[model samples]
Target: MITKEALERVRGWFAGRLPEDWRAAPADITVDREEITVRLTIPDVDLPADTAEAEADEARAGRAKAFREETREQRMKIAQEAQHRYERKVSWGVSVGGREELWTHVSAPVMTRLRQPQRLVLDTLVEAGVARSRSEALAWCVRLVGQHEDEWLGELREAMGHVADVRRKGPAA
Candidate 1:
């Protein structure tokens, strides 16, 4: 958990540095569980103080409007860049099998590329007892299953069929 003083220091820094025309670039502080998080948005630069500033106020208004639009675009680009960095850093682990069995552990940039609904389906299957557990299901889905999940389920179904066959045939028989 970050201290209140720490958060204030950060807010103060941004408030002092950001441009006047930003309108609002205040830091938002929130506490989640034991952690304190701060979200900060950069301020847009004020319009230039050239002769254009002394001309009709409408011209200044137009420049300010253009600046705000440009700032918004820059903010979005920055957000995307930050998101890509976060996605690269965050570790989402998927482990297969139990103790003494072959367990493949996957992580990082590999995890986020996974299709959302397909991942959810595997999670649901694990909850429904089709797969063993959450981690097991995720690992099986990611590593063994290819991009085409329907085809992968068909393969799993065939493997399950063979297991049932072996069970019915018996080693002694």
Candidate 2:
């Protein structure tokens, strides 16, 4: 859970820095700055209702079994498959819009002077629909930090330079 103040500062940074085009997309985007977490809801897959409860309960009482022996193996297999799938899908990039949304979720401390560039990247990703929201983009960013680290760092550096220019130019004089 990010502190309230940290969240406010990051939002302030966005409010002060984000470009109009990027901000124009619906502002309903939410960010949690402390945990460096962003949350977006996607439609969840519906699970089938269990219909064998009664029979299973009777069998459980007679057998005194507390767990499914077969389920353990199945769970391991599913876990491995999911991990493989995640690795394969990790390359998917977020839209710029989503990247902006992600920047909104990051803390002001970590983003520092490069907040806007980070925001831009995230926003671009979101607009492209590579990620569903800021949080997802951040997650993906963190996951691929090793590969995309230089690009991200470059964006941060660029943002810092822009901020410096803004400060020096004094807001359009």
Error of 1 at 122 (Å): 8.1
Q: How many backbone clashes does candidate 2 have?
A: 21
Best by lDDT: 1
List candidate 2 stretches off by more than 4 Å: 1-114, 147-173
Local lDDT at 164 for model 1: 65
Give the distance in Å from residue 20's predicted Cα in candidate 2 to where it truly belongs. Answer: 60
User: lDDT tens digits, residues 1-173, model 2?
Assistant: 33344445544543443334322242232333222222222222222457365654454333222222323354345334433533211111112312211222223334334388897887787889989877667666776885768787657756765676566668565
Sequence-dependent TM-score of model 2: 0.23
State the lDDT of candidate 1 residue by residue for 1-173, as single tens digits.
33344445544643564445443445443332222233433333344556463353555444444544565554445434433533321111111111011111123232445588867877798888978965667767666546567686657756765676666679775
